[model samples]
Target chain A: MSTTVEMVRRPSSGAEQAPPSGALGRLRWAVVDGWVMTGRNMRHVIRSPEEIVLYFSLPIMFVLVFGYVFGSGMAVPGDGSYREFLLPGVFVMTMLYGLGATASQIAVDTGRGVVDRFRSLPMARSALLTGRAGADLLRALLELTVLVVCGLLVGWRWRNGVGDALAAVGLILLLRLAFTWLGILLGLLVPNPDTVSVIVFPFAFPLTALSNVFVAPELLPDWLGAIAAWNPLSATVAAARELFGNPGTGGESWAAQHALLLAVGWPVLLIAVLAPLAVRRYQRLSR
Target chain B: MTDETSAVVARGLRKTYGRTTALDGFDLTVPRGTVCGLLGPNGAGKTTALRVLTTLLRFDAGHARVAGHDVTRRPERVRAAIGLTGQYAAVDETLSGRQNLVLFGRLRHLPARMVRQRSDELLDQFGLTDVAGRSAATYSGGMRRRLDLAASLITTPEVLFLDEPTTGLDPRSRNGLWDAIRTLVTGGTTVLLTTQYLEEADQLADRISVVDAGRVVAEGTPAELKTRFGADRIELVVRHAGQLPAAAGLVERVTGGQVHVDRETRRLSAPVADRITALADLLRALQDASIAVEDVVLRRPTLDEAFLNITGHGASERTEVAA
Candidate 1:
């Protein structure tokens, strides 16, 4: 066994210096470390093309199956294609589904002792959580890009032009960011990746099903429609549909009328409520 | 009690998980440039103490200073000075060996150029140069552990903690890790290792702290602990089975100790305080009686025996009261 005598004998120079102190220095290091961690996660996605394919297939399958198999039977509340009405919901649903990946990845890291190793290092405390959020957002961007092309191929054009369309994409990402924080929290709370996988579906299915992701909220019974319209996932889906100039934007409920406000408000609120709790849980992981 | 001479020091450290106490008044002191093994059974608080000292876990009360910085108040400083290889191989399995080292070096704030250079050097040193590009998931158990250790040494920390570093490894891999640890200590890095294997403690540690029920039950050098627990024993096998009784009587008369005679094996055994003199007299007495001896040996108590004597239980037995 060759010893690490060379490592000890060499002059460490700047490498041995203490991490910079103070708020600004800390924030700067946090960004640097978080980026490094993000790069690691991105590499995982790149190396495992099958994982990317698996995630992308879900959204693409929804687009094809809903657009072709069920298009003739389904009805839109407004004068637009059923494919158009369904595409926005599918985009938002894909983002919601991403919650499982984020949660399971974090849970795997924690269960496998990777997070403990990070915690023992001198890097910024928030780097792991922030890195997860950043990587998931980037991944959500890729998924959206692919889904957008798929939607365009299926005759689901955004009639609201470029600016409103960009806003719609932004709302979908915002919802993804909020769900990212929720995923981080759940990942930290859950014991392992298998448990996260088991629980995320039961939690996410009801969320997407009860929302306006599929049927227009107005089509459901009065009591059920109220719950579906107010669902957080519904807000983003409705907002995205309105922004894209797609059909199924009609509803008398305050939530549907204020979809744009709720789209932004719900995400911001979820982030505000979940981010700090996740951070606190990470800091108190040993307890 | 932070001091330059002590790499790790703990005084009355206490931690509880609701109703269960994980660390109750745990105390230790590891001098710089030496290996201190925290030897214990399962659920014996060894890992908890290691976590607390490494700044991965917070203790409820008392104090700890690691690498001359207060553990609770100056955890970042402690973290900066220390490297910890947890019981599990914590290397990123998705990453190649070189990438794992580079990532850790970058996290430690090394310059990009330095990170690359250091990672290459580590890969070469650990004999992973051939497989440096392969993902750690494809590496064997020993290779992954070597990568884990290499990752921890990215910054050549002043203090390193290994929590059962060879827990699940085969003997060959375990020996390889032991040799690596020996080389590291020779390079002057202070190491505090926790292990349930008494042989591991004896092989690696300069000082061993026997832990039981969340506290240090005994602390000493391996030899010192062995001698403290029991005396050396002299055993001889008689060539003639009929001479076993004669040898036993002569052994007791010469050594002034009770002799255990095994007629089937024609063996006589007795514990001796003055090992050398007792052995010499026993051999002379047996020769005088014309009782030929086939084999003779002196055996000191093993660390396993010392641990059992100190903890009042075998090292592998889990104590119910320990949380």
Candidate 2:
């Protein structure tokens, strides 16, 4: 290289002294910055796929644990394939499991200065947050796909046609989106990434275990059953099971139709509760 | 570094975190085609002021215009006008240097072809051509820093904000950075820099502002601030440890100020306005008192001393902020 030009790593090259040139030009610049960060984040996930594998493995592992170990001894209060009854439970639990895992990603971003890097850039305020939500939702959808493939191999089949299968995936994706928002809210509210696991354990245990995903909603205790039926995860699982005839349980009722409404509603409610809070917390982060 | 216009201006800037103010009625003006250094020690609101200017943090009170647009009212426009290398970021460790620069170019909305071209150009310019394809995770601290700066320039911003551009670098890297900055300044780009290193300010800043406790205590050319706030440091290394007393007395007689001695170093030191002339008189008096002198040196007070005098604590010492 010639001697005229030297390498520089200064945070600012010469920005503080130059005059403003154009207005439209700068807005376009920020939009572009968002895409760059999005690509960077997605690439990071590609490099470290351990989280993806673990997330996908969870539902399949839960299915085996319950089907062979608990299925024969357990009854749905009727003669139905216990495998079919348990399948829906595992699927719903898989979707809800995304919440805490999503939080850990946000916490890591906060700790690693990735958030700080974007905060200092010319990118839009919503870009980074929106990008994170987008990435996590996609991750959840991928995890769902893997779990569905495993379910198919394990004698779980959807009776509904191609359209219904797409709709099932869509419903699960939407539910995961809601959970992801909740995860983001928690990540933002918490102080650091290290505390994320501690926070995650509490949310994971009850949200996954007490829902209709593992046992029949009716088998739960009088007080717990009512709460279990209301879990959005329960609604989603019931809807999917209604669409696909689970291994042996063939009870498709109006509850499946209502499950659609609940699946959509849960995310809306989560966004209602968490979106603004997350934005406000993010706004204060750079301070 | 194409010929660019004025990058930033902040007038009547004030910010308070709870009851403790971070920036108290601070004002700054940076003209086009020059490097303006925002020189200050720790906790002096330099970062706060930069944050406000970058549109990262909003001030409770004050009018700030970056790239000729109000920072609060038109943040995106300000962001468009400048590039912030960022105070605490390096490269995206997951990406190669070339990928990082290209990604930033794409984010700035450049055409895909142009992004590739710009990335290549930046890699060549920053001496990162060889490692352009390697992930930044494996790069040294200095290489990562260079890639970070390269990322910042993907848009060819008219203005730049560099906060402590060379704090932890070795001398060679620091000099390389200084040369790079000089080239940028020569080509008429605007720069705002904040640094604790006085020599960096003296070498690069068109003007220096000494900030302490969230206020600019002094602002001028390095020589001018030194003249106004700095006194000559008259130091005496005693011939023998016992001669420290006689040497201290002679210094007191010469300067009419109490001489201070560090018990550990066994040296006599005093402040005097005319360091060069005072040195001659001090040597003569010490000899007359038969006080042997091991060594003597007269110098202007360093910014460290000036910071202690102004802020009442060494800049290096950490003071807990009331959170």
Best by DockQ: 1
DockQ of each: 0.57, 0.24
> Which residue pairs clash within candidate 1?
none
lDDT of every predicted structure (CA atoms): 0.88, 0.71
RMSD of 1: 2.6
Give the per-residue Cα lDDT of candidate 2 at A280: 86
lDDT of 1 by residue, A1-287 (tens): 46544744343423665867788988998999899999988988987899999989999998988788987888878677888899999999999999999999988877777878899989988998898899999999999999999998889888889999999999999999999999999999995888887898998999888888878989889998999999999999999988898989968999999999999999999999999999988877767
Global Cα lDDT for candidate 2: 0.71
Task: For candidate 1, write residues B206-310 as lDDT tens digits.
Answer: 999988777898899999999998678899999988777778889888878888888888878888889999888888888889989999999987888788889
TM-score of 1: 0.93
Candidate 2: Cα lDDT at B158: 67
At residue B208, give the lDDT of candidate 2: 77
